[model samples]
Target: MTPLHRVGSALAIAVALSLVTACTAPAPTPSPTPTIDDSAANTPPPTPAESVAPAGGSDPTCETIIPAATVEDFESLGWSAEQDDFRVGATIIDGGLQCVWADHAGPATDHVQIFGWAPIEQDAAYDAQDNLVGEGWVREDQPDGVYITENPETTISTDENGYGMTYLFGDGWVKVADTKQGLLLVVWGD
Candidate 1:
């Protein structure tokens, strides 16, 4: 009799739970997005903050730059001992002077052009004795203009016409930087 009563109680509880579950409804699912007619044809586009800049834009200084030249120095652009008829040379451009030299061709007149990197004070040129000859500087004290230590001093001055038009060598118009680096630095591409 006791066992039969216990089974009857369990059946009653189960029936009650089943009835409750059947009456309750499941929760509704959420919608993916809202549907609305914005009608914002007259509204202007939102302007982004000035801090957001375009791509590929970097600081100019970060663009593979060489140092500025200083006085009493030579920035050896294409340093070489000897090649062929085309030896190597150094150009010096400080405040008032511009000069360059090559093998068998001491510091001569201002170079027609120097296209590579040249930094002042940091770059050094040496005499035969390995003494400090010139430090890189745009405004050097070479008042005598460009001179090569060959048979005679080969020189070019601002006073000379067509100095910057015809390249003494290479492919650009022969120009010189105004009291600074050579023409290669001052001018850019076509």
Candidate 2:
């Protein structure tokens, strides 16, 4: 072939080879997408602070309200007793004892609260129960007394961490207990 014909033939062969290589070449593999973790997002938010009533009534000593043996048991478990003015929700107990046992170094959920008062009139106790029911508490009448609680299934147990109010009302006495939060109120007298 002539020099020009040779060049033309070489160019045509090179172009054909390039086209075939491009059409037959394997495509590049794609990288994997990163995963987003959202495990913490599913957790429930912390409970908001409840409205507290103004401090009133007699502030009894923790030792007086909690028996010596119970106090010793709490001490043995590394828990301390705290006493303060008696109040429940937005109501103040005029002459009552507020006692708490918990580990001060631990979280606030680790606590047992108690409030006790005697000579509470039946009408006043019922009135208190009505007020609590108005505020979303559930009431159940027992054979000996009335039981009011924020969550009826949640009881005051030393072995469990619980949240909500548990109040027991007798003919002339009221006792309140809050396991998670250390506060209670007892209504006494007329």
Candidate 3:
């Protein structure tokens, strides 16, 4: 045989051997499927001794003021509750319960703050409505009281306004909700 033919034959044999080796190689073991622990999500919030009352209004615990289902819904959205004294417009009324739910890992504007004052006098409720109106908030009269809001229409999450503030004045209660990141606050008073 010619020298060139022998070299060509050797190259063909090497290529055939490589193909056979690759075909016989063992298949790699796949990583075990990861298990997610969702126990925290199912856990319920603590229950306090008594229901919340505005009289002398010692600041109510987060558990007392917010419902378990509400808190769970917020938690599902990666938000957690923080209880603190909150400011509404230009006033910080005493003896009110404030609960703010926010994604601590996210931006500062991603939060929902709710301030509720019960057993409020009529005069104070009117004063709060007036204060919000003076700050360019629109007022709508409800059968029980008034509903005042910075933006009357629903806000989109990407809107430049960033947040919306709403005040609900009822018979003996007043609630202020400052919401951003597309959160909705619905409060009912007894």
Q: Report the number of the highest-TM-score candidate.
A: 3
Model 2: CA > 4 A from native: 1-60, 105-119, 152-164, 179-190
Q: Report the poorest 10 consecutive residues by lDDT, candidate 2.
A: 45-54
lDDT of 3 by residue, 1-190 (tens): 8999999999999999999999999899996532223343244423323233446735455544545566676677777767666345756766665676667676676445453444467887778778878877788786746767675455432223444655667677666655321112233233
What are the clashing pairs of model 3? none
Residue pairs in collision within model 2? none
Residue by residue across 92-160, what tens digits does model 2's lDDT show? 766665666667766566344454443466787878889988877778786747777775454435213
Q: Mind sharing the TM-score for model 3?
A: 0.53
- For candidate 1, write residues 157-185 as lDDT tens digits: 33222221111111221223321223323
Candidate 1 lDDT: 0.28
Best model number under lDDT: 3
User: lDDT for every model?
Assistant: 0.28, 0.56, 0.57
Candidate 1 ranges with C-alpha deviation above 4 Å: 1-114, 120-152, 156-190
Runs off by more than 4 Å, candidate 3: 1-59, 76-78, 105-119, 152-163, 179-189
> What TM-score number comes out for model 1?
0.18
Estimate the TM-score of every prediction: 0.18, 0.51, 0.53
Q: What TM-score would candidate 2 get against the native?
A: 0.51
